[model samples]
Target: MSSEVLVEKRKLKNPPLNIHTLGDRVLRQSAKRVSKVDDEIRELARQMLQTMYSADGIGLAAPQVAVGKQLIVVDTDPEEPANQPIILLNPKIRRHSDDLALGQEGCLSIPGVYLDVRRPAQIEVAYKDEQGRPQVIVATDLLARVIQHEMDHLTGVMFVDRVENSLLLNQELTKQGFSKQAVKPVEAA
Candidate 1:
């Protein structure tokens, strides 16, 4: 397939300033499962990448843009210049190591917030590439954390749900002038 086919071509427009935040009703809803790979989905993925890159974020999910679909785009290559994006369709974490690490993470949806979130240090993910071809990749360190973080958004989970301590959450909220409240912990399966 051509490089053009591998990258989404559509441009995502900026959302209105009134776009919903983390506690909004739209974000909490379970995303719809994607059944087909079409031009629209591909375009949406492209737009997602554009929005993410514009916000200086490494990853973005469909729900973050108010579209509840099982899709995400990630680019964790810090060395590369802007615009290298990876599209993931129906991603699944097939294997994950027991070793855990805490990483400071932020989200595009929940802006001006950062917290230490615990995640597996390594993971093997299986998903369809941009061309709808099956691809499995083993990721460690930052890449693994990025994958896990984006995948959680597909399930309506946020980084705040995985925070290692309340102190970190409080610090983030206080910095943003938001009230501090206890967030329910994400149960490990």
Candidate 2:
């Protein structure tokens, strides 16, 4: 994420929403475009961050909380109190580097399982900030990886579905008590 801008943390009266699991139908639904950025959207973002922190996650999407909206929250450095979590509404990757990298990825919705997935090493994204202002971020490394991962969730995709290692994926899913059928591969073998 771009270092210049800082997102602020917010307090919420409502509790965090429940995160759905891999096989849940909610996670497979493609999220709709956010029509308007309102108080509700900001509130949802706040609750999502809370849920993400509660789950020890660095990122989350609205679909993970059963909301079919194109919104995502990400914060790679949760330990840094000043490192506020980002709230992106209707996020779109404007550009991505041709260079690809294999990174270990995990999901709060698919807890207990992590997998290696190949994705662009960097990206430029355009979206609306919490206040409905236009914002763009140039992200690399973990921030880049996290943004791509959460963006997948908005499109009915999961990290395990991108795992290239079938053996490790199967073993991990089994040990994690997740059904192998839950994996819907995006790439053809």
CA lDDT scores, all candidates in order:
0.75, 0.86
lDDT per residue (tens digit) for residues 18-106 in model 1? 33466665666678777888888787876677677666678888887788888888888523654456788889999999989888898
Which pairs clash in the backbone of model 1?
Answer: 12-47
Score candidate 2 by lDDT.
Answer: 0.86
* Per-residue error (Å), model 1, residue 71: 0.5
Q: lDDT per residue, candidate 2, 91-147, as tens digits?
A: 999999999988898899878888889999999999988787899999999999999
The TM-score values for the models, in the order shown, are 0.85, 0.91
How displaced is residue 82 in candidate 1, in Å?
A: 8.5
List the pairs of residues colliding in candidate 2. Answer: none
Off by over 4 Å in 1: 5-20, 179-182
TM-score between candidate 2 and the true structure:
0.91
